[model samples]
Target: MASDRGHGITHCDDPRAAQLSGLLTRRRQTLGLTVEQAARATGLAEHRYTALERGAGHGIDLGGLKRVAGGLGLTGQPRETFLLLAADPDVTPYDLVERRRPSIEELAHIDLMEPNPALITDHAWNVLAANASVARLFGDPGRAADGDRNLVLWLLTDGAGRRFADVDEVRADAVARVRAALAQIPADATLQALAGRIAADPLGAGLWRSRSPRLPAEASARRLRHPLYGEASVLVTTSRLPGGLQLIVHHAAHLIQSPAPR
Candidate 1:
């Protein structure tokens, strides 16, 4: 029995190492290649190839490894594993979001809102992105102040108040809308930045000072001067998007009934 047991049986040392080594062995076995045949094809001796199959060989040439992989019908497997393993083990699926942020920003221009003035706002109601009509109607008026856009401030402050038919009602509703929007935002950095900008406005200051966000049961109507439609009253509706992006869509109200000419 002692004479029959020639050299010691080679076994992989580490469990993870053994698992990966077993995987390689399986790959080689699946290709119907004997150990000697695999070694000869990759220019390695049978003993060295056996050590590799046992997951004990180091200093194996990468090019030769590729050849051995090819001989073992692991051409795609090595490439796929290289790709999968080349990534940092600490790298998580969440890191993919960071890499894909620009794509999401690009998608913001995908024209989600219709032609009637749609804008993409982050939390706190400060417009981060806007469409052409949005830029034309609201943008031309120089809505940005100190790099901040508080819609409530626009309705309550300076010459901007004249833009709305009844600034008081509009300001109150806008403030309420901001509060509603704020409630939906998490403590995200983007949201906090917008909130900080908005809070810099005088009306926002007052709203913050009150520390009370009231939602009136009755929705109010407000009029705005559209670049094309002179004056229009739109019943503003607020909605939350999948990623907490704020979408403001303005629908032209029904034209008031007119008396027939005598």
Candidate 2:
């Protein structure tokens, strides 16, 4: 059973636990405080604080870490690191935190109601959930993957890849972003497989290796075509959620046709 910590936060995945515990212990010692004193200052039970200082903050949430950080006089990036590490450790075990599935369902429902198309990917870039409008316009996510479902894989390998006006540019951008993301989780088997598949493919291997990676744009105007829509201008936006999830939304941008010069 999940403890009353609220987010079903689990224990740190070993290495992260040790690192965090050591940092907290050192910080407390520098401040010259007993565990009980530190716990009281942080608004945590002494045992809970002890568990955290001992590299076992797995069940701890961001707020708890914030309290600890405040008690430790930790500010700036060090404080942020504590919050981030608590929410998502360095190595996720396929599924780390128990996602509030109902909230995701709600998000999908709301997204589907919009005129735009939206899809959600898990940490490994697998297209786990999507809205109805996307399937209606683009090809179905069902036929996208050979076995596992990844949107980037589908885009790189599928015939629909040709639908972009600047297909090569689109492809290069996608490959670069995927490469950069995979760098963060080297031990992830799914990511390794994806990287291997990309590297082996004649189409994307060169692009993956040669292109300079760019940070993924938060939002960008893109052009795509469909037999029915003819061609549409889309504003693509990506938002990040806790637990390494990403929500990608495609909103149709209103393109005002300018008068042709005489």
Candidate 3:
């Protein structure tokens, strides 16, 4: 009787739908799973799974999306990103990136944090602005070579040499964050290239492939061997800012007393 598409299945033409479809297909292929295998893993019928991969299953519910994410072995922020895209295929992290430049008010706030190392970063963790304290603690990002001002990049590459006492732990966490961010904005060419560079490094590649828990934004104590200030202890905290930016602060930092040499 009805001729639109037989069983009332409507084709979704949304660009986001296409993006989601591509992600699903790529992820399945990356895992070396066949369509049937993916369907089984997702607990969905073969045809339904295929439809989703074709961007034709826009009507899938949240429960269905959750099953898909779980079936794909996605965890932490990556899982959250998958569900978010499923809910609204049109979401883009670019809006936040577009507004990345810190406002005068934000700059003033950073200034107020004086004496405590503070910096602002965009969604991709590019160092947008930093206070004088941050420059003093970590070398000035402004002077970094083009495309080298990213927080994660610095952590993965320069952190250990810079005397970060918890370099391994910090590097792993940074890699996890990058992985999640990549999933959220799969279409970003810049981020894709950055990920490639990170994967090119042996340690970074190992950490990227390994599973790690997502760290919360709770304050954590960190030890740094400051070239000038000597060994120091600081409490690091991160907070979300407007426009998909992050405010990271190193608070209450003081030089650590070294035991008298024998």
The residue-by-residue lDDT of candidate 3 on 17-129, one tens digit each, is 66666677778878888888888999999888777766665678766777788899876566565566665456443422334588998888988987777899877788999
Models ranked on lDDT = 3, 2, 1
Misplaced by over 4 Å in model 2 are 1-102, 143-146, 253-262
Per-model lDDT: 0.52, 0.67, 0.73
lDDT of 2 by residue, 140-258 (tens): 77665545577676667665465666667778877888877776556667777888888888887988879876678788777776545556677778887655678887775232132
Score candidate 3 by lDDT: 0.73
The worst-scoring run of ten residues by lDDT in candidate 1 lies at 93-102
For model 3 the local lDDT of residue 199 reads 90
| Best TM-score among the predictions, by candidate number | 2
lDDT of 1 by residue, 216-257 (tens): 333346686554456668665555554345566554433222
Report how far off residue 83 is in candidate 1 (Å). 28
Best by lDDT: 3
